[model samples]
Target chain A: MPTTTRQWLLNGHPRGRGIEIDNDFRLVEAELPDPGQGEMLLKTHYLGFDPAQKGWMENIADYVAPMNIGDVMRGSGIAEVVASNGGRFAVGDMVFGTTGWTEYLVTDGKELTRVETELSPTAVLSVLGTTGLTAYCGLFKVGKPVAGDTVLVSGAAGATGSIVGQLAKIAGCRVVGIAGGKDKCDWLVREAGYDAAIDYKAGGVKEQIRELCPRGVDVIYDNVGGKILNDMLACIATGARVVICGGISRYETGSLPAGPENYFNLVFRRGTMAGFIVLDWASEFPGIRKRLEGFVKGGSLKYQEDIQHGFENAPQTLQRLFTGQNRGKQMLKL
Target chain B: MPTTTRQWLLNGHPRGRGIEIDNDFRLVEAELPDPGQGEMLLKTHYLGFDPAQKGWMENIADYVAPMNIGDVMRGSGIAEVVASNGGRFAVGDMVFGTTGWTEYLVTDGKELTRVETELSPTAVLSVLGTTGLTAYCGLFKVGKPVAGDTVLVSGAAGATGSIVGQLAKIAGCRVVGIAGGKDKCDWLVREAGYDAAIDYKAGGVKEQIRELCPRGVDVIYDNVGGKILNDMLACIATGARVVICGGISRYETGSLPAGPENYFNLVFRRGTMAGFIVLDWASEFPGIRKRLEGFVKGGSLKYQEDIQHGFENAPQTLQRLFTGQNRGKQMLKL
Candidate 1:
């Protein structure tokens, strides 16, 4: 590793349509410092990029505080403890947390989760990290799908939605997926075990969903919001649940489209729509991680990552999330 | 007792703005219903009218099946059991249920909820019956307002809204009300004990709600939908719960105005929006009714009924809900 560490700093708040690396972020280098007592030097291995990062970089009112200019662009990643002073972590113990877009970080064991189990650390970041936990809790806890119910997953070829579809199937549900293109749609049914896949780009989303589900969707795992959300809302069954995890389609592209025009069906159908962040389920992370590990080891889970090499490409890679260019979990591999 | 009874039959499916009696209904006089074994004859004393009645009358997808043409219009009412063949009901018992828009009904003692308290039957229709139970359950059960929370209630001067406001206030939350007129606004703060009230007809509803709930609203009990629901959605606090009971503003008026455009705030704030109907909570009605009775007896609950005289005015009285002309529970006394 170099004596000087490189980190991308948030240079300017992202506005409508521009989130390019040169326009919104600055890469800065600083000399590495030794760890103090009760502190450790951590080296980034895998940088986890999520659609929510766009909201954090923007000046808009969002779930989290906007990343201030000149601050390290906020993110989550898997890292290895390089040097430590008497504490829970030792040198080379892998851990994952929000370590930001940095080559290395010094921490006092705060917000870090050990990458336990013999499974590959890269797999942990892709499927068992925030992505898997989010899919697990949002589906079962919020969506609450039961056997024989129809579950609709938007952005179904993506990281979280892929896991959600498989889980829904495991729970004895009829899973339907909505994707932008034919390839992703094919992947949803062929690889992810979704019962059916609707290519939303073909239009007629409402009619397609209606014909596929027939009885209307029992739960909607909405990742890509905007018009797709409205389509699903229009066809949701009575006592349905919309588990809102991400709105990647319009997160920071430009203006947010209106909320679902058919949301009142929730009233007529006696349904619920809830939004959640994975951080709120930290207490159950261990159980969630273990279950995800079992799925992986048992070959029941299919995982993929759009690995963008080098920390320097972090900001550029983040743009793919909103542009429908990312196939799965978009990660920065150091 | 009269040898013949008059009832309003759904003559045509109401569409657009034609909710007038002569356009959509016909008054029919039928021979009085005679009770058989395990049955009773219910004399409708007060016919309850609600905005949802329009949905029931139309051939539309709704919470309940639309009333068929030529069938007696579906409605709830306060009634007295005039004759009983045995089983649960006795003569002279005042009860409230789905007794329809008729002067008399015969039932097998199935759905009637006994109005046993000393409060007037009119008060029972307004506060101790479905109206009050809806407010209680939708607020406490679904909205789940915590102490010191800020609750905003749309239609705060109407029957369900009036009760929701007081109940939220009693739960140790700062209650803000949104009503149409200055008189209704004044009544919300004065009689309903709402901490603040915004007169929506005066405009700047979003601005007023922002000013009143500077910390952001924690729970929103929405009786009206459309623009005001959108406004509340834009400014709700983290973990907020939006309780959707009725959309009086659009239930009977032409097409449903598009669903609230600001609903994405639920994602940004990690909040929830649920739509519920009172019929789902029938098992818990006894508890809700008892709690509301205590509120009334202790003088904490104040209720008003916009009582229109005579059965002939039932169709016209039902219009008041959609027009915002009814101050409280809209009931037609026969």
Candidate 2:
């Protein structure tokens, strides 16, 4: 008997408009093959959709290789190992790794990390996964927020920003968040314990930032780097730190964003601005994962999943991120 | 009889023109008064002529207060104590501080550091003073170069840049210097022990930087922050540090000098760009000064001073720095 599977592929490179979804992906049935030596055949349950995926689809070379034409879209997914070839794991084992967007996958058993079924499978792909890890590394390692420091997090309602704001609050730092809508802003302050939230869509961001952060921002966790980053530069305190994790605002433009106009303030205030990549701190992942796992289990750190049904909806879910339609962690249900 | 002493005062504020020597300052003989309680009379020996003094005379506020019209021009100077009332020092003690532009003056005992005459007297105002401390703090503390790292310094033959290049060499780094003239470039490579020197006066800075630092720049100590700082950004390796100690090029411009056209390089390379003020590191000075004094006494570090004659030439010597006429520290002999 043949098994049926559905998969998503990069149909075409996105220009200024957005990524295009087309006939590149196919739903087909194939004969189930026995596991080869050291290979595992897995069933996909949940797929992680992220803005970083859009960055990968653009074919621009960065820290990682871009998705090639007609290749299965690269993503993080939670899966069940239906069959195993060797002693690393037995049948019915759950795992996660850099798997493609598909209903089923065959891996060489190299990068697969076995997951404990007692833990929420979704949490492994969200808070206990790359999203939480990126937030941890950027905030603790790069941002280096001290107790009583004032932290400003841009993209505050998003997955990484939400986690960063909560982490800052736990560290006893006053946290201010910047998001797009009133609902998101409210959620940041009310649910995430952010001291305040600025709606970037409401206008007067620079002035509002100055007003909200009277002591001036000690740490700025930047994900959307354009006018927001430029304005934040003006409100930085002495010895402030600007952490660059992403530049989503200028990503589709396919060119470098305009440099911050008030960077000279760095000299006057004795401040620093640095960029970070989460993979660089992979050695410290176990520590972060343990802490984040505890928070998630204790309900101290909450994550919202904006899941789209069906693997076919992966492209549209990614569009929600750029369009600001998704509330939290945008994911695609397999 | 009252003693007559010559003093230079800020007569008028200069506009767009290079500080007009005639209209900007006026020399007059003033009656000397006895040192009051908690006050001391200082006989100025060498007045430090710095480019910052030009901005001080512009009628605009900077990091420090602007020079008031008719007030003595603000500066640091090596002085001999003629009389003392407070018990901090004796009559023959040598001191350095913001002693202003005058042959003799009375000041409160605050803001003065007694210089040990056993060490080189000129060094108390040059290498062991603000200029050398600025270089040391900006490089070792901010730039944070590691052994075998490739360090690039802009304004490489200036007082601070020259010392920074030598220090990077001492720390086991391959030092590349960027200066204006072939003579200055040769001095940087031969005398300062820089591994290579790029004459920024000649064209092709970007290309030359790429060729010289094929492995890419690990640290860039920037004093000149116009085109040279921009060029250094392209050649920076991953995790490089850029220290912004000063921006001499933008000091006198009517508008801000155009910032680096490629600052987005910071994001792609996962690097850091920071600016520092020397005063913030004031607490660390005692340790830095002790080590620097040993280097100077052992003849491992050499310093040069372009000592111009007469206090009347202070305004002109300040202008020479902008025109790149003086070789090292520009000072006026009282």
Candidate 3:
């Protein structure tokens, strides 16, 4: 029998207390198994580290199932097919799916999507995967940006916002970004084609947003809710639209973040604020995927990866997202 | 010179707290002015009494200008053009516009819309006016209810909600109404064709809503925003839409209403909460007016008027609204 490595499990739920890297997880070993009917055995290569994974560790129920105690940490990963019992893929075929944090995973062939070598495997797990699709659907379908509209994006240099800013520019909108640091702000304006970038840590968000968007913002792609969203609400123009894609700011707070106090601005300005999840537009994936891929191939869109070196770093890498430490899409390499 | 009784200025601004209804206004005898090259002299008949008028009374910056302290209170009134100097109307033709609370007035005829008596003068101020148009725009344009979708309407016995509930039912939706009392709830079921009714004052709004909408609410037309809006958020189905038409509960609080705490539910269920103002769809009024008139004429849509006897009672009558003392559309008889 060929030798195999076993997976590790995160031991307990992280609720009120902040995540402690040392006490939260444990490692274990198990026997290797043969591929069953229509199943494939996968060797994990690149693991995706997202802020949502922290949510999985916490007790609060979000859009998906919560991670259970003693379960392999839930995540998406790029893998190589080692043993296949299906016609869809063979040994050496590359695929991606929710394989959790592990060295090897056995899943039904239908669960994995076959990827082409033309695109980088890491890119498929980052920009061309769920994160990219989420930005596309939330902006176009819900935000509905028109040409010449002023678009304000929170978490502007993060995985989703970087792509969102580029896409808005391509759609002929004037984009303004809100990021945490000077470096991210500089990158957003210099590399991502943002018209203006605001460093949220410096304060005066409402004043800076007012000065940047004198006519007021027409579309706000909000990733970090709480105070930033409240400030955005005050700066929205007549008939504006606010798209709530994520609320990363409140993820670590012991209590729910206070909601926008000036929500009545929606009533007077005749604006709209809506929240959405990416899975709702799963039916439109093929078309959006082709367009996003074309943008990447043509160099109109840029995908950045903050790749962590090993599997053991997954927990620490996810912590980087909450601290605003990662530059772009955070990924783990094994 | 023919004598005319007019309510005009006694000074420039009101003194101390509360609306000074008694000593602040004065009745004077004046000569009726001749119409200018393109103006008309109007004789008043009925005036619209709205809570929005109270907003105009307060000295605050809003979408429209506030009523000056000593000036005739700004109001919407039905008037007859006693003398005309243009092609728009002849002597004794009926018209409607922002005519003040007075027996006689003169205007350029430009802002006055001719009232077609084929539709009652009262209908011009009720269903064919701003109240009806607000309900029409919100229900069709924002809520976008489909056949068989369940719609929950707050303040379902008020001027707008009463019409909104019937309209939703006419559009083939199962309607549930929320009112302040059992009598109002009965009125919504018996007169407005609502499938179920909940008296919010009696409590258990969340439980009652769940019982009424087993499949969950597809759309909610919220007027009284506060705990009711918060409670309604819990009952929304996948892809539900919450239309914020007005927030009467928060109006008196002098601050924005606390937004629903479970707003993250928008992402969990893939739903949307959008705030709207009627003026955004002003261009569609003629089309909506024609359809709504048909309903009123055919007896499919019935409106109840909570008529206050005289203009002198306007302030006291306005108090009826906040206390839930009035039944339907509150209007003042001149």
Candidate 4:
């Protein structure tokens, strides 16, 4: 029988902060797309929420283009193949890629990479997926942490940040985390194995980091950019390496926000700030994934996923991320 | 017989623009001290006036220390060894190092590097000394231009920029130059062999760059930093390398000014902005000098020196650089 698919389409641009973006998306019903030759029908299982999605909603020119009006809000998720006309995949096989915000999608299996892990699908897609790779390549390739180096990670309790802090620790460096609220701070220290945690909500983030890492930061993996980045730029040691992993703090803005005002600190300290995307190092993933998965299973590294159920609440669910309501990797179980 | 030496001493900090520094220096007479064991007395021949001298006068915490009040202002120039107790440097042999601004000075011969080249003194310091080393090592090590790549240099007709542009040409890359005046622009295109030259004084630097290098700038050797750097930041191609060789634009300001407002473009383009000091690569310099000298003698590369006779006019001489009165390498003959 032919089926009906429910999806959220971007109808308007976000205007205000927090849940303001809730009104930008509308839920609608569409007919299920059938698989043709060399194609497969994917049934959505889980949607991983990322700050980059906000960039797509704003229609701003950046690393990636903005999502146009009436388009299914772009997102990456884990899904099952319910029907297939493709030779590579059989029915009941699960694949991961940009499945969008929909219950069902028909693709030629062009972009999808088959999920081949025995662990829970959310665990693989959350930590072992793009989130893990982003932090892994960004820290190792760009930041280049050496033994006894002082590493700082902003948004340290979040999905990617949490993984980055642990990876830096495994490299035999002191890991300091900057996160908002007390719960996140506690988790970074108690669960994620950070050397120290700074509560930005309590203010004095710069002072705390200074007190903790008196020798000065050797590398920085910045997810949140703004005054926080400006303050940290001043405290780097000579020949420091700063990796621009993401700038979630300014993603909601209409125009690209001004860069950190104190970037000359790079000159003062003779440092290097390198911006990169994980896909640039995608070819080395098989080795990296095996390493990250070992850390996850060995209990040396810990990750958190904030999962919610129900596809109807997609808009408000995304709002949870911006409002600081999300505890970890924000995800929706459909 | 003991001789009296004339030198400029740092008397005050500069507070305003355009020769305000005239008051910052005071002419003083001091007895020429005799060289001790393993020491030599140097007779100053040419004092190289560079923008970094402004930083030395300000007494700020940077790569080098600030000149103290009533102390001989720190500078690097070419000098002839008049008397020597050290065997490494012989009497009448020319040497290069930080000889400061003086008619004659005595040194322990510790910092002086022997000048073995047969070229004229000003030519060696102008194109083959630290100025040339600053451009050569900076462009190759940090900027890392590849063949057929598009390279842009600011301060185009000036000492460092002229060498950098020609080096890019030698590397088989397309080179563009940005200079402040039409004459400088003509020299860059006609004399220095740049693919194109933009008169930044006429404005629209970003547009001109975009139009000339449709493929986008692969590497930028930036000598001036300010809005000019901000504009160039916007035109960099993906994975571009930006070498922060100098920031002459804001050197005279009282405070360290804001960084490029468009620096986030580094993240968008997945590029690198690296800061380096020429001394860091001093080991590779003997080889770099031979290569640069060959290009100069072969007629493929050219350099310019705006030489003013007299050490008494050193204060106003530096003003020529700030006010754009000097056409090329600003040099003061003792």
Best by TM-score: 4
What DockQ number belongs to candidate 4? Answer: 0.54
**Tens digit of per-residue lDDT, candidate 4, span A105-149:** 888877787887756778666778888988889999999999999
Q: What is the lDDT of residue B235 in candidate 2?
A: 87
Stretches of candidate 4 off by over 4 Å are A13-23, A62-66, B14-19
The candidate 2 chain B region of ten consecutive residues with least summed lDDT is B252-261
Docking class of 4: medium
Mind giving the per-residue lDDT tens digits that candidate 1 earns over B57-142?
A: 87786667767888888888888888888947789988888899899888886878788886776776779877888899899989
- List the candidate 1 regions with Cα displacement exceeding 4 Å: A34-43, A80-94, A105-109, B1-3, B16-18, B30-43, B80-95, B104-110, B113-115
Q: Give the worst 10-residue stretch by lDDT in candidate 4 chain A.
A: A13-22
By lDDT, rank the candidates, best first. Answer: 1, 4, 2, 3
Evaluated with DockQ, which candidate comes out highest? 1
TM-score, prediction 1: 0.92
Candidate 3: tens digits of C-alpha lDDT, residues A57-122: 874765687678888888888988888787368899888878888898777867678776367878
Q: Give a tens-digit lDDT track for model 4, residues B114-194.
A: 887756667767788888888888899899999999999988778889989999999999999999889889888888899
For each prediction in turn, the share of the native Cα contacts (below 8 Å between chains A and B) that it retains comes to 0.69, 0.58, 0.57, 0.56
lDDT by residue for model 2 (B1-334), tens: 2376888899987655567778889988988887788787888999886665766787653557667889988888988888888836678888887888888988785788888745768777778888889989999999999999999999899999999988888788999999998999999888887899999889899999999999999999988887788899988899999898777787656334456646667766789999987878778877888888888777667778988888777778788888888888888787
DockQ of each: 0.60, 0.49, 0.50, 0.54
lDDT of 3 by residue, B231-295 (tens): 89888998898898887776565456676766666766778777776766767877888899998
- Lowest summed lDDT across 10 adjacent residues in model 2 chain A is found at A23-32
Residue lDDT tens for model 2, A39-86: 778888888877777767777746788677777778888888887787
How many steric overlaps are in each model, in order?
0, 0, 0, 0
**What digit string (tens of lDDT, one per residue) describes model 1 on residues A1-334?**
4467898989987766757668689888977777778888899999988877777887685556667898988888999998887646989899888898889988887778888776877777778888888899999998999999999999899989999999898889999999989999999988888999999999999999999999989999999888889899999898999988877756656556566767778888899999887778889988888888888788778878888897778887888787778888988899
